[model samples]
Target: MTPGRVIAGPGGGIPWDLPRDRAHFRAYTSGKWMLVGRKTYEEMEGWFGNRTPLILTRDPSFVAPVPSHRVVGSIFEAIELAKRNGIGELVISGGAEVYETALPYADRLVLTTVETEIESDIHFPECRDPENWTAIHREVWPSDEENDFEIILQILDRKSR
Candidate 1:
């Protein structure tokens, strides 16, 4: 996401190409159970590798291309499925709506804040309330040959009530 919280540009695609960020994402998400919206799932097709995808969609007729992928109706259902599969952690990789819907139940948030802002229709939901979350980890990376912009990678954990 950008400094403005923009996740995807007006064209409904990510504006920046950051290989370092991509590698970071893959490092944390590989072999994990990922929950994503239908559009996000389609956009990220063939990128799953060893990870399992739980696609959230209201369409009952929608079927996943991969035999291992699961289509679920809601976030809770996705959680239940992951629990049944003995998954200890579920990663929420999202489009806008999915992020908004899952925000309440999120225990931790892994975020990459790009230094620049771009024109975007999709924005990540606000979850930065100081009372609700604490930044447990953060790393600042400067632009490199592979990455166009500086980025702040952060891990925020939900504060206990």
Candidate 2:
């Protein structure tokens, strides 16, 4: 979340602008296995080619696109699948619940803080503590014709246990 703690507007609408999309792609989405909640996956249509999708849901009969995606009942199952597939970098592309579930174990957070005040129904977890996390990368993107607000991309790494 940005200083305002807004991630999505009502009905899962995105609050960030276009430049943030590209920044997000470079920072978190490319060449990674993304663990997403069922609603999140559904919102995304299916899966994108750059990253594999692991859908996490409690619905036992939930199905995902064949040969490319799969559904997991728990985060443990998702991690185990990542291990089996030899995925070193995993992305938790979230809808609120999944982010909260993975927050404690997440090693890094790639956040694009948009400088704007907007109402939102879903908020990113306020679990980041300045004392325990370090910002390793920071880039500021100014608003242009295509973007409404300035965006700051920060990659935060949790301090060693």
Candidate 3:
């Protein structure tokens, strides 16, 4: 996401490329159960190495291309699937709707805010309410030859009930 919370540009793809941010995303989500919308799952085709993905879609006829992947009808179904598989944590990686649906159930949010803002059609759901979350970790990375913009990576944990 950018400073403006833009996740994807008008082209329906990430507008910026930050190698460090990509690396961080890969490291953090490796071997984890990831929940994503169908469009996001399609966009990320062939990217899943050892990670399991639960793709959320309203279409009951939709089938995941990968044998290891599962198609779920909703966020709750995805969570249930993960739990049934003995997964203790599920990473919500999204394309707006999925983020919005899962935000309330999230225990932690891992976000990367790109320093610059650009025209975007897709935005991340707002979940920065101080009453609901507390920043647990934050790190800033400067722009380099491989990355066009500086990025601020943050991990916010949901406030205990």
Return the lDDT, model 2, position 42. 83
Model 1 misplacement above 4 A: none
Predicted candidate 3 versus true structure: per-residue lDDT over 30-115, tens digit per residue: 99999999999999999989999999899999988988898999888888888898999999999898888888888898989899
Please write out the lDDT profile of model 2 over residues 47-109, one tens digit for every residue: 467678899999998878656887899999999999998999779988888998988878998
Q: Give the CA lDDT, 0 to 100, for residue 76 in model 1.
A: 94
- Candidate 2: TM-score? 0.91
Task: Write candidate 1's Cα lDDT for 1-161 as tens digits.
Answer: 99788999897877899999999999999899999999999999998999999999999999999999999999999999999989999999999999999988889999999999798779999865668888999999999888899999999999875
Candidate 1 lDDT: 0.93
User: Lowest-lDDT window of 10 residues in candidate 1?
Assistant: 126-135
- In order of listing, the candidates' clash counts read 0, 0, 0
Between 1 and 3, whose lDDT is larger? 1
Candidate-wise lDDT, in order? 0.93, 0.81, 0.88
Clashing residue pairs in candidate 2 are: none
List the candidates' TM-scores in order: 0.96, 0.91, 0.96
Q: Pick the candidate with the highest TM-score.
A: 1
